[model samples]
Target chain A: MKIAVDAMGGDFAPRAIVEGVLLAASELPSDAQIVLIGREDSIREIFKEHNFESSVVEVVHAEEVIEMGEHPTKALSQKPNSSIGVGFKLLKEKAIDIFCSAGNTGAMHVGALFSIKAIEGILRPAIAGYVPQLDGSIAIMLDIGANADCKPEVLAQFGEIGSLYAQYTFQIERPRVALMNIGEEEQKGSLVAQATYPHLKANKRIHFIGNIEGKDLFTNKADVIVTDGFTGNILFKLGESLYEITKQRGIQDDFIDKTNYESIGGSPIIGVNGNVMIAHGISSPTAIKNMIGWAYKQVQANAYLHIAQALA
Target chain B: MKIAVDAMGGDFAPRAIVEGVLLAASELPSDAQIVLIGREDSIREIFKEHNFESSVVEVVHAEEVIEMGEHPTKALSQKPNSSIGVGFKLLKEKAIDIFCSAGNTGAMHVGALFSIKAIEGILRPAIAGYVPQLDGSIAIMLDIGANADCKPEVLAQFGEIGSLYAQYTFQIERPRVALMNIGEEEQKGSLVAQATYPHLKANKRIHFIGNIEGKDLFTNKADVIVTDGFTGNILFKLGESLYEITKQRGIQDDFIDKTNYESIGGSPIIGVNGNVMIAHGISSPTAIKNMIGWAYKQVQANAYLHIAQALA
Candidate 1:
């Protein structure tokens, strides 16, 4: 299997990406191949310091880099030779099995949506992340900063996608899918949620588990929680901030500390046609390495195929 | 000043409400008075148990109660003699200086909107809460679960209300008001947020501090953070869950233990013409007592007058 890496994408690009690539290459199966996409000169310099074999890891030259601040669509169109653009192009052409980036998420999402495109029957792609709950359980929340304004139908689709992803990835059969709302009652919630609740209940594809409040998120009330991108993004950020604050508060608990961004590694962009992974822009060497490994596992599990089939 | 209490609203009911009313009557200045509204028999029985003789404490009879699960609007119309309905009516008639309830939030919001009415310049009433941050700071987040569908102008109004509330309640001058978005960039957020950004930036009423991500919520990045009701509710719930999870993990910090529903009292319903306090339905006796005291302070502070003046 071959994987494409956007070497020039994150805050600690090229160097960290190179180190992660080399680490992943060393530990990966003997038949695995890695392609690094970025500016050739910088990548070559980093590669020279490591003295790695050329057969296992190869570099593909790209002329430009998309800055984190650049507008995603304009940047991709203007800088087609950028590492992210080129890596996505490679994925579209099936040159690589998976495409990995720890770059600007907006740019990554835009690139994936227009390049790889959404899976058949999927309205919009969603980003799914595992949030550590109180009982050492993980809740899968989706559309964490994808499309902000979503219809009731879109949210129902998210429920289906989230349930399928949780079931396949976490190995939880009949994973409970709950819609996030202010209150647990079906009558409670915003207008969109009120409209979506009955639809989710009627759908046979997802295990609709009624409404789950944010307070139940940390508890094991549901395995997969679905929400619109606006709400999901807010919840994700709030959870992330809470973890950071608790860790910074000098509480030396291993469990809480282990749930940081580094521990979670990366989030998978579900509903895309191919396996696409997005890491935190500030990911370190260890995080990048884990993300690469995660991408490989997703490919091996054929998670994308299962998700497409479930949605279909 | 006279305060009206919904004696049969919360889980604790007449017992806690009666106790809170007596406590507030005893602790407040001699000029203060309390009117407990509920079924006369239950209110009288609760007051008899207290055996307190103060000219300040009185009971106003109401024949019905609104269940926690009942629809707010429908219940309000069907049960006009309910504790919440009668209390709000008393408030509307200028029979009480302030109205307090631990009833259903939707009922309180609906009752407050129609009965107490919105402030002159306010477009819609917003529910605001203080989210405790890491550095001994608090970020005031608004519209936690009020309006589901929101306009850009409504979000801008929330920013103004939140900023003013933070300034008056938390004593933060020149409070930074941030629009919650997926990213700090101006271009990143839902369409509503995007449209509101320029408006918030141009408005002189608030110290508009650009966009803040969910991760920035607990980092002291902004004193007042504004978002639509849907996203804000999700963020608030996530924060509440994190706080709960952190406490469960045995991180018994004073703030966490104190502020959990058991402590820190209730949330003041802002944007109303008068001071209307809403406590958690599952509030403890101590929380109920504290909420009464909080209501008394707001009445004394003339919170509504200050908010009106500031908005003006």
Candidate 2:
């Protein structure tokens, strides 16, 4: 299996990306190959600094670069030779099994939506965030920053998508899926939430556990929580900042440690036609290594196939 | 000023509520009066336990009690003799300047909407929450759980309401108002966010600062942040639970101390005819005391009058 990585993306590009790819390559299966997609000369220079064998990794040159601040759709279209633009091309042609980037989030999202496109019959692809539960377990929350305004049917579809990711990614059996609402009672929540309740209840694809409030975000209430992008994104960033606040205050604890975004490196853009992964822009070498490892696990598990069959 | 206390409300009803009232009474101005609305017998018993002066506190008989679990609208209407019911009646009659309860949130909300009603010309009454900034200053956020689905006009009105409260209460001069969206760019965010952007920008009544994202929530970006109730409620509860999570981990820090709900006690329900406050259901005696104190400040500031004039 071959994996294509955007070496020109992220704050610590080329250098950190090269080292992380080397680390992942050394530990990966013997048959697995790494294709570094970026400016060829810069990537080769970093690899030579460590004196690593050039035969183990392949270099695919990308002439243009997409700055983090550029508009995603415009940047992708304007720079076909950009690392992100070329990476998507490799993934589409089946030259690589996975395409991972730690660069611009909006760029990655747009690339996923228009390039490979969402899975057949899917309304919109969702981005899932890792939630550290109090009980030492982790839960998956989806649509964190995509589909900000969602209909009831879209929320119902997200339930199946979130459940599939949880089962294959975390190996949770029949993952208990819950909709994030203001109250646990079915009658409670906004009009959108109220309309989505019945659809989630009747959704036979996943174990529907009804509504879960914001207070239950880090609890053992449910393994998969589905929400629209607007609320989910706010909750996601709030939790992330809370972790930062606790850290800044010199509060040392194990659970608080899990809140660190570095530990989970990146999140998978599930429901997409092909394997696509997004890492934080500030990812370090260790984070990039973990992101590659996570992508490898997804490929091995055939998670995309499971989701397609579930939706089908 | 006369304040009506729901002595029968809160998790520690009668006992904690009565004790908190006594604390507020002693520290309040010489002209202040405390009217305890609950079971006449139980309230007198709590006052007797403290050997407090009966002359400073008055008890109004309320035979029925609204359970925390009961439906909000149904319980408020069905139980007219309930403490919450009697408190609202006194507020409506102008017999009391303020009414506060920590018993049930929904009940407090329903009672406020039905009894005193919203100030005329106000699109919707917005309930604001306090956010503890990293700089030790506090920011007021509006529509936390009310008006889950808001049109562009409602959001504009909320900006003015929040600005007035911040001016009179916190004494912020020309408080900077900002719209909460997915991105800081003017064109960023969902359709509703897009629509609300121009309205907030054109709202000459407020000092609009365009948009702020999830990352700027606790930062010093804006003093008054406006968003629809659905997203605000989720972020509010998520922030509240973060305080709980840090506390459970036993992480002692001054910043985390601000996250404690007890410090603020209750959040004043803005855009209403009369002053009203609601505390957490599990509020202790200390939280209750703080709730009463906050209500007193709002009454002193004539916050309601300022809001009405601003809208006019």
Candidate 3:
């Protein structure tokens, strides 16, 4: 299996990506191949500085780096030879089994959708994240800003996708799926949520846990939580901010680990045709290393195949 | 001035309410009076336990109590002699300067709307809470689940209400008011937010700080944040859950201190005809005491008068 890494992306760019690739190369099985995409000279210099051999690590030179502020689709279109673009092209051509980037998330999502394409029946692909709950369990929140406007059927699809991801990723059997709403009552939410509740309740494929409030998010009410991209994105960001604020307030807990960027490493752009992992723009070297490892694990676990089969 | 207290409300009920009223009475000027509305037996038992004087606190016998599980409007109609109902009656008859409760929030909101009614020009009254940000500043977030289905005009009203509250409570001169949206761009948001943006921007009475994302909420990007009740309620509850999760995780900071129920006490229901303070149902003795003080401040400040002037 081969994996392509966008070495020029993220805050800790070339250095972190370089170190991560080397670390993965050392620990990965001999059958696994690694390719780093970035500027030729910088990649070479870093490779030499790390005293890494050229045999296990390969570099694909690219001239441009997509800025976080750039228009995602426009930048990807304009910069065809950019690290992100080239990396996705490699995955498209089957040159690599998977591609990973720690760069502009919007650009990553756009590039993944256009390059890899969505699954046959999927209306819209989603991004999922784990929010640590008080009971030492993780809540899997999906569509964390992938598609802003969603239909009731689309939300039901999210419930299926999110529940499967939680079952596979967190190893939870029969993951409980809850629709994020303002209140637990059937008549409590926006028009979309109200319409979606009945469908989720009737869906026999997944364990529908009914409506869960935002306050109950951290209380471990459900293993899998589903919502539209708009609300999901806001909730995801709000949860992230709250975690940071709490840590800043000197609240120390094991759940508030510094390994957030490192352990989770990156978010897999699920429902896409191929394996694609997008890391945070501000990820560190350790995080980058973990992302590469995560990509490899996903490939080994046949995540895409499972998702495709589940949807099928 | 006379304030009616729902002595048989909340987890601690008459005991905590009696203690809180006594503490508040001792701190206030000699002319201030309190009416503790509950069953005479329970009120007298609490008063006897505390060895409280009858001159400062008056007990109004109420035959019924509104249970947490009961429907607000239905319960009010069914049990007119309930403590909450009697308290509302006092406020309606202009016999009490203010009515405070730490009971069922929905019931309180329902009773307040039915009893006190919205102030003259107000289309819909909103619930506002102070969220402590990372910068040690509080952002007044409003319409946190009062009118879930709201219009742009309702959001603009929320902004106005929140702006006025921040100016008076936090004493910020010309507080910056921001509309919460997916992005800072003018074009990014639901139909309601997009329509409300231009009106808020044009309103000379408001500071109009533009659109802010969920990530910017805890950073104190704006002093007054407004949104439809649906989004506002989700955000408010998310903030609360974060505070709880972080506190449980042991993240200690001054911001966490501010988030404590004891410090923030109860939230003032804005746009109402009379002062109505709503404490958390799980409030402690300290929270009840602080709520009493907050109620006193609101009454003295003539919060309703200022709100009327601002909206006039």
Candidate 4:
């Protein structure tokens, strides 16, 4: 199995990316190979700086780079030789089992849709975030920033798709799926949520646990938390901010520590045809290293295949 | 100034309500008075338990009690003699400078609309929550749980009214107003947010600071945080939960401590003709006591009159 990473992504670029890949290479399974896609010379220089040499690492040269501010469609089309473009090409051709990047988020999202594409029955592919629960577990929250505006049907399907991902990937049997809402009552919420509740309830695909409030976010209330990207993104980012806000005040707690974006490193774009993860633009070497760990688990879970099969 | 309170409200009801009033009576100004509306006997019994007697505390008989789960409109009309019903009646007749309760939130919101009505030219009355900023100051967030669904115009108006309220009530001149969105860019966020952006920006009534993300929530980025009720309620509750979640783990921080619901006690109904506050249903004595402090400040600020004059 091969895991492809974009070396010319993120703020730190080739240095942080290559250093992270090297960190992952030390613990790599014999069957797994790390594929670094970017300027070959730049990656080699970073590898040499750390005196790291590994047979498990391979570099594929790409001439162009996609900056963080570049428009997704425009950049991908104009720079087919960019690292993101090349990484997607490898994943599409079955050369890599998974593709991970901390680069232009829009570019990575657009590249995935343009390359492997969404699963046949998927209405929309969502970006799923990992929320650190108080019980030392993680809950999968979908549509973190993908579909900002979601119809009732789209939201209900998020419940179905998110449940399947959690059940297969996280190995939670009949994973409890809950709608992110203001009130726990079925009738309470925005018009979309009110309309979506019935659809989720009628659907036999997921174990609908009714609505969960904002206070229930880290309470280990549900395995799969579903909402439109707007609410989900704000809530997820607020949860992530706990770490930095508390740390700046010289305060520390075990649960708040997990709220750090570095702990998870990346968020997966679910409902797509294959494994694709997008990390923070400010991702450090440690964040990249942790993202690689998740990438390996995602490859092993192969939940996309399960999602496709279930829909079929 | 006559400050009326519903003693037959909240989970603890007359006991906590009477006790909290007793606690506030000690600090009550010579010219200010607390009018407790509920079963007079029940209230006096609790006051006796505390060995408290004060000229500042007065009780009005309210024969009926509205349960927490009762329908707002229906309960108000049917239970005309309920504590909440009597409190609103007093507010409507200008018998009290302000009315406060920890009863059913729906009931309080509906009662405000039915009695004092919304301020002229106001699109809607929103529940404004006090968000504790990391800087030790408080920012006012609007539409916490009033209207579940709000049009773009309603959201933009929240920014204007919130700004006015913060300026006059919090005594901040030219308070920075911001829209709560998924991204800082004006073009980003859900369809409603995208449409609402231009309205807030164009409104000359406010000092618009553009979009603020969830991470900017406690960072004191804006004095007035504007959002639709659905998103605002979820985010506010999530912020409030930080207190309990950390408290259970034996993790304590002064900043996190302020996130406690008891710190400020109650959320005020903004854009209404009168000053009205709705506290948490499970409000304790300390919470009620703190809420009274805010109620006193709200009356002194007289922000409603300012908003009414501005809209006129």
Which one is best on TM-score?
Answer: 4
Model 4: residues with Cα > 4 Å off, grouped in runs: none
Question: Measured against the native two-chain assembly using Cα atoms, what DockQ does each of the candidate structures obtain, in the order listed?
Answer: 0.66, 0.64, 0.61, 0.87
Give, for candidate 4 chain B, the lowest lDDT window spanning 10 residues.
B46-55
Say which candidate scores most in DockQ: 4
Worst 10 residues of 1 chain A by lDDT: A241-250
Model 4 — interface RMS deviation? 0.6
Q: List the residue pairs that clash in candidate 4.
A: none
**Location of the lowest summed lDDT over 10 successive residues in candidate 4 chain A:** A23-32
List of clashing residue pairs for candidate 3: A249-B252, A249-B253, A250-B252, A251-B250, A251-B251, A251-B252, A252-B250, A252-B251
Q: Tens digits of per-residue lDDT for model 2 on A21-104?
A: 888788777767888999999998988888888565899999988988999999999998899999998888889998989988
lDDT (0 to 1) per candidate: 0.81, 0.85, 0.81, 0.93
Kindly list the per-residue Cα lDDT of model 3 for residues B291-311, writing each as its tens digit.
Answer: 877777677776677888876
Q: By TM-score, highest first, what's the ranking?
A: 4, 2, 3, 1
lDDT of 2 at A106: 88
Docking category of candidate 1 = medium
The segments of candidate 3 whose C-alpha lies over 4 angstroms from its true place after superposition are: A19-31, A135-137, A246-251, A258-263, B22-31, B242-253
TM-score, model 2 to reference: 0.95
CA shift at B238, candidate 3, in angstroms?
3.3
